[model samples]
Target: MAYQIFFREYFQTPPLTRAYTTACFLTSLAVHLDILSPYRLYFHPTLIMENLQLWRLITPFFYFGDFSLNYLFSMLFTYRCCRMLEEESFRGRPADFLYLIILGCVIALFFAWFLLLPFLGQSLTTMFVYIWARRNPYVQMGFFGLFVFRAPYLPWVMVALSVLFDGDLETELIGILIGHAYFYFEDVFPYVPGGWRLLATPRIFKLLFDGELENSDYHPPAEERPAGFNLGAQEEQANQQQRNEEN
Candidate 1:
């Protein structure tokens, strides 16, 4: 009973038991297969041990980085994306967000491994998906070095840099795209009410509500307004004062 409770809290859902376990198993299998490849038993691609099809299903959802810096940044970015979806989506339950991510990763990986890697040299689809999703207008990744950008466009910018600088961060980039599409489709059509939608709605609401509450110029209608002074004039005055300070 005690062990069950501990497991429940620590290795709860999503990648904890499901995706994480699957990834470790696949990686292990890949290593073993690689060892036996010279015997001509295992599939050739699997022997190369570079994002095999089996690993496709879980690798994108797992931490690709073993080192601290990369691992930390990946976790931070992934967590923020998950948190945003969790709060913003109406259709997504906590489990659903993970489900979409896992599902998307798997789908993208399959295409990359089976369809692309055999011909294209790598699975660029994963990278493409992340770039596309982070481009969503609603998303905004926080401050980076000297520049702060809205989330949706951030992924694309990184991809551009990736192309320019020739970094191998494409898989992580793909993860973002997979995460994004899962949320979008989940909201627009919504076959599963309890999935990704859960993350998008309230999360987006919080962002919008925070902005609304902060901006004085955008007044709720007289009947709709939160209890306070006239919102319009207050916002105008605030803006004027800001401009004055700038001068």
Candidate 2:
């Protein structure tokens, strides 16, 4: 019984987020099991360009490292950011959320290629965190039960944590740059005077992923059948008094 309930809830996770988080988990698990190696996963331009190793472009964003406390925390954070962004900020707009993911990936890819970064799993998670933070600026979050701050400061705090713990900021900083660029173009520019929406989600994407679910065959219960926006809704049912019976 519990297993069935768990399966139902797991399948009900927002589709895009479920796919993304599942991919990240499987990638890391594959590495942990020795079925895959980091050497083939990390971003390397030369291997991609000359050797036609195209998978390098994708694997880096999913493979974080062996299982550890940090790895577990990063995955949880990634899942939370993605699920919230889909279920709240981008609610009812799956296509727009998809466009956001594609745009962020492209920007992150260019930066990773240019900077010769090996892995971007953490960086991609950071970018999602940054965007979620920007859109939800008023939500308060605590850091290791030490201090609490608003959502707007979350990304920078992560960067500081990275520096303090790992002594590295390159990957997280790259993510911040990509996140800010996307936030400005999508959220800020559209509202400015003499500005236009440069980051609008494409029409085809809406046609593909934004389909609305409806039940055209459904019939209203007899009690509510007579009320609607159209004239036909007033038609008498057997349960109602006929017109001839009225005074």
Candidate 3:
């Protein structure tokens, strides 16, 4: 029962969120079990171009380095941010959320290929974080109960922390840039007097994912007319009797 409650509360989420988190954990488990080498997962242009190893495009987004405390924390953070974005900002709009994921990954791939960067897992995680932060700008957040600040600064803080620990800002920066560009186009730009929506979710996607019933008057048929009920016949007989009395 406890395990059932845990699964219902934590594991159950919208379709995209569930798929993403499951993929990340499954890939991480494969890495931990030594089924695949981490070296093969990182983004490498030569492998992709000459060998047509296109799986590298997506594999990089699943690996979060060797199993450790950092890996666990990264997974949790990714799950949390993804859940918030999917359930809150993109609520009832799974297609739009999926579109954001595709867009972010495409932009990250472009940068990773050209700049010779390797892994993009952290970058994609940061992109989700950046989007959530922007959507909830007024909400207060803290880093491991240490420093507290508004939501908008969360992505920058993560980048600074990454620089402090790993001395590499490439991934985080790319993620932030991509996230900001998306947020600007989707949220900020359309609100401008002369500006129109720049990122329209495809109609096919809306039909596929957002097909909630819109008919307010719709209702289920009455339960099987209670075993041969004949109210219609009785009403017709009464009408005929009233007509005969009037004549």
Which candidate has the highest TM-score of all?
Answer: 2
Cα deviation at 120, candidate 3, in Å, is 0.8
Give candidate 2 regions above 4 Å deviation: 1-8, 212-247
TM-score of each: 0.43, 0.81, 0.80
Distance from true location, Cα of 31 in model 1, Å: 12
Instruction: Evaluate candidate 1 by giving its C-alpha RMSD to the native, one decimal.
Output: 12.3
Per-residue alpha-carbon lDDT of model 2 for 48-141, expressed as tens digits? 9999999998888888778887777778878899899888777778888888888877777898888888888777778889988876654679
In order, the Cα lDDT scores of the candidates are 0.42, 0.77, 0.77
lDDT of 3 by residue, 1-247 (tens): 9999978976678778788888888888898898988888989999998999989999999888777766776788688899998987777678778878988899999999789988888888889998888766556788889889988898888777776666348888998999889877776666557966687776666667677524311111222111113335544665787799999
Candidate 2 lDDT at 82 equals: 88
Residue pairs in clash, model 3: none
How well is each residue in 1-247 modelled by candidate 1, as lDDT tens digits?
Answer: 9999967854544333344334433443554556422123222346447644453333333423233443344344444444444444312244434444446655555545654422111122333334334323433345567676655565665556446544445454554555455534543323334533333324343344333323222212443221222446645765788799999
Instruction: Count clashes in each candidate, considering only residues at least 3 apart in sequence or on different chains.
Output: 35, 0, 0
The Cα error of candidate 3 at residue 59, in Å, is: 0.8
